[model samples]
Target: MKKLFAMLLTVSLLMVSAGAASTQSSNWAQEAVWTAQEAGLVPETLNTSYDTAITRAEFCSLAASLYRIWEANGQLKDITPSSVSFTDCTDEDVLLCASIGVVNGVGDGRFAPDSPIQRQEAASMLHRLAALRTDYAGSTKNKMPHVFFDGENIRSWARSDVYWAYNSGVMTGTGDNAFDPTGQYTREQSIVTILRLYDASYAALPVPNTEAPYHAVLDYSGAGVSRMHLEDKDGNHLLTDFEDTDGYFYDITVFGDWVGLMWNDNANVALYQPATGKRIDGYIFDGIDEKNGVAWAWAYDDENALVVYADGTTGKKFIPKTVWSEGRAIVWANANTLAAIDKNGNTLWQYKTSFNQDTLVYGLGDRVVIEQDNTNTLLANGKLGTAQTYTIIPNKWSANYIGGDNGYYTLYDQNGKALTGSYANALDEVGQDIYCRWVSDTQYEYFHCAAGGNPTTLFTVTVTNGRPGVLPTDGAGVYALQTSQNTIACFDRFGTIIGTIQTPFTLDSLADITFENGCIRVTRMDIGADTSTQTMLYLPTGEPIA
Candidate 1:
């Protein structure tokens, strides 16, 4: 099979080069260069500069040509991108590539058309092309992508696309066990990578639907009397049954299935599964936050004391420590007994240890992870594996990153299968399918990746002195991360940095950053005063809420 695949690839590259090129490329890329030229992927302007370094604009022109060829050959779905105009560049091909999402401009509305392109930047563009490929694993199962020797050099924001390029075989390294992520790339090298991306797009899946269901919140802003309304983006009523969602409610956040409804401030709260129009169950707390169909909150009275916890699924006193997508939740059956029980309060598995307060339990998709006695154990299928003292960060909606004793980690899907062959330095943080790894002493890599039975699309960035994380949240539209001591970068689901906010406080004082009801909620701590305050910035526009 490998031999056949290699032969087919060779034949594809060797097609239609009868007239040959007037200029030449490196000895290694001679054949690929001519093939790209004959296939109309190489323009006449670049025909003589095969050995020279490729500029950003020049590469986009090449990509645009390839895109046009694919569209003409009926290989791609016609995409009508929005009008893309750049201040520093008016190159038609570059603008065309940007319109179709093949590339992006530098900040401050400039295209930098004449600037040279880096190898990783080139891979990033190729990765974008991979997304449009018919066989791109957007909504399907994707086995792990490749791991490189210097993955840390790849920025967290570009990691997803870079890995996709590597995993899909659209890009290759400069030999000697390195991707040379920041190294310069010549025109011939760019052409070959683009050709690989072209070959893989033959089975391109339809562009992924970005507007999948996410939890939405409604805050009355204290106007109506304990009342709320639910509507879609177009202001169409989604839950008309709630003529008046009455209660002394502080706020309400509902998932699309409406199985998870978080409301607050009342003595008790009743959760209604709006889809079925049936009341699932209810509990009393200061507030309720749900994930993977399980709602949790702090005890109402004695806020600092841990007591009176109940099952998230049922109102029984199982005291759900953590819940996974699985039908079961790991609960504290009693003071000294930890157990996994179903919705009916039946124990499927139990761990008897004096770890009521010290232990931490987190969900990684349908799997459960237990941290007790300085060891971490993987729990699944009603069984617990032998505990090991390796660092582990559990992602409730995707794969888990388990670091070995060597301090290098491998990402594991729910099946406990390795997601990357090469290991990376793991950061003990979690988010909504978002993971960060230590890239260097001062730099951290952040990427949104979740793999269970399948994988979510990946987005990444590399930054220094930042990238600490958040416990998962249902805040869907935009995510904010403090990228540096005084800068918080905001990103969409695709992991694009839509905008950034310059913060006033130092990194040490920034306690937490979260998204609350479509705003960036930044929490800051005053150490001497022992007080914490939260500030909100509106989303998309990042305007101060006040």
Candidate 2:
């Protein structure tokens, strides 16, 4: 066996010697040339004159150009040159490897680029990308409490974050007692780790489709505050300074013994009575009701009816009670009244009311929902209509609307049509006819709109896995929204930062962020992060801390 191996080695060397031919350093060279004919690393004139295959020294000089690009931007922070110098390799080779974190040392401490990356080391790096910090300052436990698929083998030091990563789906176990924590994690494993850290669900809010960035102090008050009967607009009440509790406001409403709070976005808050539950912000309004530990209030309708003062109509006509549903506000004034109002407080349509003033009304989109005495019926033009009655007993109509989330303002409609033309998109976020942009991951390579523009440039990206829907930057332009690694970034048109929120979440499930005015709306998971107990947070455009 030994003789056969030696003979095979001898034949290999003989073949190499026989095939040794004059080296051609021209563009026509089959192998990669070190020349710069097509922006090659080496100058074509010099590289073409070589009589042999490019030597290690020549390759070093050829590749040194990349150093200049790095210098122009900033010092390579993560990449460091290998400690040990190789006799065969040039300075450029050592420096290039150092700058890219490929090789770190020499001799006993030398990092051999050709050597396989150890499984343990790979797992450690993977942990970093996943933002899993076992001894992190914010960490509550010294070791992770959860059991891993490969639980027993994880080192005590790495146990905390390792456990977090596995439970969060950032890392899957080997289905055994050892996660191979010391084992090399593959590229796929690393990507999955990054994806799981900040899952896509944090970026995507199902109810409101709001904008959410990682590490940003979101304003869940929009949903949570609304639950407390506090209603406000997208940008209202949210203190973007990371230090303050973003305030939330809700519309108080009542229907006899039943009262509930409604949110600015038209979602129902937990119901309770003002007389029973603890008062927040000095409860002083009518129609307060509490039930099942939830508190709510009955709001009053302050908006005046649209009285067509045109020729001679002068009496104050009761503007049907407007109730918000789905995304539009519906109202029914009299038996024959029907109308749809948009977010801008503009009336989309209005129909006549033929029944008496005492007739009870409900908001039914295409038709009128009328309740006379105890009898409920569908009123066409109001004469007798189809007879029907509602036993469920709907809540009474109140006209109190805070301006947005915090402030309330009364809206009076003009006796004119608001929707001059039909909307092409009934469900579009910005509206189908708005001619806005639909950005997938590809469209944002050159630029991404995190908040108020087309493409912002001046910012930093920490973790960019090239995922489909992760936010590119934190919401601040002044501080480069950087991932802990500074790998990915999102920018706007004027070269300002829009978003740079990072999380242990994936881009695939991230909620779409909605930037209304200057406020950003997004949802986050409450995974030990007390900040995201609610579904939505309203942060100011560049000020997300508060």
TM-scores across all candidates?
A: 0.36, 0.20
Model 2 C-alpha lDDT versus the unseen true structure: 0.33
lDDT of 2 at 22: 32
Candidate 2 stretches with Cα past 4 Å from truth are 1-318, 326-351, 364-368, 379-385, 389-546
Kindly list the per-residue Cα lDDT of model 1 for residues 74-139, writing each as its tens digit: 777556787989889899999888998888888889999999988888877876765664545642
Clashes of 2: 106
Residue 299 displacement in candidate 1 (angstroms): 59
lDDT of each: 0.57, 0.33
lDDT of model 1 at position 16: 35
Measured with C-alpha atoms, the lDDT of residue 173 in candidate 2 is 52
